[model samples]
Target: MDQVVTQKPHELLAETLSTKMAAVNTLIQTRMASEHAPRIPEVTAHLVNAGGKRLRPMLTLAAAKLCGYAGEDDVKLAATVEFIHTATLLHDDVVDESGQRRGRPTANLLWDNKSSVLVGDYLFSRSFQLMVETGSLQVLDILANASATIAEGEVLQMTAASDLKTDESIYLQVVRGKTAALFSAATQVGGVIAEASDTQVQALYDYGDALGIAFQIADDLLDYQGDAKTTGKNVGDDFRERKLTLPVIKAVAQATDEERAFWTRTIEKGRQEDGDLEQALALMAKYQTLEATRADALVWAAKAKDALNVLPETAIRTMLVDLADYVVARLH
Candidate 1:
């Protein structure tokens, strides 16, 4: 027999699941439309049309496939996950007052904040409708809790954003709420919908939870380290916004008194000046916080890979392990 070579994890996942993803796209379009308020669809479409990796939805599909699911509800669940994710992005851009997303103007910029917020609410409602269609109370409970947890994470982040007293434990909680909740829910629902064993469901949840933390950490590190073209974001965007991500948190923990004042002025007080970014980078380098942050990301990525051990060995599992590796590989 001729050997079959698998492509990269994401690409292979996309190819393997292309047919289902197409169904998901169709469902997204059909559900997002609003005849009464056409502007709703217009605002929703702007962000939805903008290119995203759709990793959450793909995780749902991959989990279902890996667990030997043979039904169509995975499509609805995947769409539900994407809707939840898109609604968050729309709301996040409004909350952040951001103008750019996925290398294009945010919906709030093109339309208005009011439009963005209302449309985001609409999508949230639509996601619930789709979730209901799955006819699984466990799936509903998981996704609903994830929605609340995501909101809690964002709220916690707002409170913790510039507080110098915020520590790694709080930071981890914030990361889990904001990023990992939906990831774990996505995978967990996939397994639940597939009727997978309890152990497999737990394994999927563990994998997603760890992968999300690592992914967010790498993203935070890249804000200080990545090029604009590569990261789809300008360097120091986090610093400019006064957001206290992991790298900044690590630097703050080790700051000298003078450096603490500098962080206070620049981060807490939003008093950044011409050389503030350079100085921030200098301090992070001095404390090796960026490297420390990368190490943390690697650890989480390893946990995600380890979580896959209980599952049956298959191509999807290999891809998932590679996906975890790729998340940390961003530091390279």
Candidate 2:
């Protein structure tokens, strides 16, 4: 008997959208190339070829198809979305001083930071070029605003990540800026290109926003309890990096004076000692903050699913709803 393989939601979406994704990949390669600067392609390819889910670009394609689009502009916008996402990863790795990404060495590590930053800027320019080719002022406006929001979020994180006063509201703002902005824009642009009704476009935006929030919250939660090999990150990396993730922020909110001192010394003062990770885990366990964070993620995932009620029921829509669940399901 043949063995049956169970496909994940993203895998299913990829299979369904394989042809469009191929075009997007081709465009990405053609645009990433630079005649004068060979290093640009090298650095860009290093990160681009790395095993990523391609979820953001896929969202664009899916939204376009869902809105009954027949034109080729969806492909261009899909490629644009991907370029923007890849550029952000390159810059983010440098900002975080990260050694690994997507279970591989980061581009900044393989090449120099200068190479990474310059190549990232090159990709951003390429993304704009692709978007301009679409000739839609609305699409350009959406993506441009998303780019600005991403930068603003990064700057906010720089100031807020180590600060003890970073609360849930501030954290939500950062998540929306750094993560959800692109997601919502990707979907929103898809609808815009298809000339979808204003209501449908808003629905797509809402779905993407909630899904992105769920995705990030799940990622932050995983940093505390996930398998390092699976997640491509060591457990407690967020704690070690002094990032004020949702779980840590929740724990800080409920901390006693002694626990507050621990957060102050480790996160605020950057004086993480040996066994501190264990103590941090113990504190989170004591407060059940991880569980609380997981609950929040689930809530967002639910909202993402609910947002799809406005769209027509189809396989793509179902997959998108399932994709939202799968992001948080990693916790299980």
Candidate 3:
């Protein structure tokens, strides 16, 4: 119901979140600063120092604390989430050939793709080590599966690119794989570590999955609709890349034969030029791709809220729901 993007004076809970997330931060710095292979410290620090929201780790810590967890395991678990997220970002930049991240030159751009890839692997290994320290076999099992799902999702996305045949189903699967799997595991693992019951754990898992999906869909929507300056990325980056995102996928399904031909030639065949972006945006508008994408994001957000019905009501729980809403609200 509430918009996520429009931040009111009293709305942001970052201050409330920082206290709980402090341990998550500590875990990240200590684990990521390991002295191994010499190059590890240097390459890894590039990513570790670049400040992102740390949302994934904060979710883990907040979920654990809300569920009455008074133990130290939350810190390690939170760190694990950050490691997985950072690793994914490193690999994603490399895969996308992206030059910028968080308004700075990406690790791959600053160093080399090879270093980014290898450092990503190092983080992945350290993530597992953090999991081991948690001593929860279920935690390990959940995260191990998440890791596999994330890798599979990345490969799926790589193949899905530049193909106009990509449908909503395929696109959703890719987003779920590449994005939602880790979110699901991060929150669910927090519940598991807190010894929450199966029902609660399942609720958190669904919440994270739906939240991740909604968050990603919102991002795709912003590619066309967002302010490039605020988003810290180029407008129509997806379009210029000719990537088959949700908006493009929906547009293809609704296109006429002539429009379909244009899509096939320009997006699929690929040779993005000056006016290609304008043509792509016009096509998307003709087919209402932005609206369709927004609807999909709303559907997932509703699903995320529905999953929260199973969670016991608490300030943290309410904030998590609010946070989910805030994600989509940014698009408005």
Candidate 4:
């Protein structure tokens, strides 16, 4: 007998789009270089080279190719998408006071918060420059609005994450702003640059939005039950950090008076003690919130797949559908 292996959907997409991805990578490198500041590239390269999936840029490429685009603008948009994403990560690590990213020490830890923030600003400038080169006002507008939405989402989370009053609706709004906005923008701009039909572009945006929501929901759920080694995050890191994710929000909704008190102390008041993580897991299990969260993720994944009905049947499209499934498949 012979052992068999299968490449993940993302891996398959990367293989199919290797040439364009290479161009995106080259453009990213060329644009990240600074004449006066040597530290900018050093900091930017740290996170960009970290073992990220580069899924957002790939989404841009796939959407453009699926729409029959045959120009270099897709590559530019892909690089632009990546720069925006990288810049967000740099800023997020600073905002969260995070010490690690992608299983490695974060740039803020490697250098300083000032360096990370300045480099992130540099990347945002670079991303805008790349988008401007494409000469499409629609593309520029979409990305610019997404950049603002991302900032607003972060601020919302800053206020909402520790509040017991946060609900599912607020959580979804934050998700849309922080995660889905960029995903949808990345896909939508690809179609815009390719001059895709309005219907087709909307479909791409819907797919990316649903996929991003499912991706974030799944990530939040994993923080409660996921394997530390596999997830690169210790179980209940969100709980420990006092962040009110979906599972916790759902659990809080169904909590008893005593449970609510516990939540207030641990989450709202940030007075965690030993075994608090276990207690949080116990509450989630008691309410079956993790299962409910998983169900929600599956629904979004289905919506993502359904959004592709308007898209042409292509290999890239198939990979995208599978990619949506793969985003929630980790829950199993």
Local distance difference test scores for all models: 0.93, 0.94, 0.84, 0.94
Q: Any runs in candidate 4 off by more than 4 Å, and if so which?
A: 1-5
Residue pairs in clash, model 3 = 4-326, 4-329, 5-329, 5-330
Q: TM-score for every candidate vs. truth?
A: 0.97, 0.98, 0.94, 0.98
The CA lDDT at 273 in model 4 is: 95
**Candidate 2 stretches greater than 4 Å from native:** 1-5
Better candidate by TM-score, 1 or 4: 4
lDDT of model 1 at position 233: 98
Which one wins by lDDT: 1 or 3?
1
lDDT of 4 by residue, 200-239 (tens): 9999999999999999999998888889888889888898
Worst 10 residues of 3 by lDDT: 4-13
Model 1 clash pairs are: none
Q: Could you give candidate 3's per-residue lDDT for residues 18-74 as a string of tens digits? A: 765776776676777755576667777777777667778877877787678889888
lDDT of 1 at 229: 94
Which ten contiguous residues of candidate 1 have the minimum total lDDT? 1-10
Higher-ranked by lDDT: 2 or 3: 2
Ten-residue stretch with the least lDDT total in model 4? 1-10
Root mean square deviation (Cα) for candidate 2: 1.4
lDDT (C-alpha) at residue 191 in model 1: 92
Better of 1 and 3 by TM-score: 1
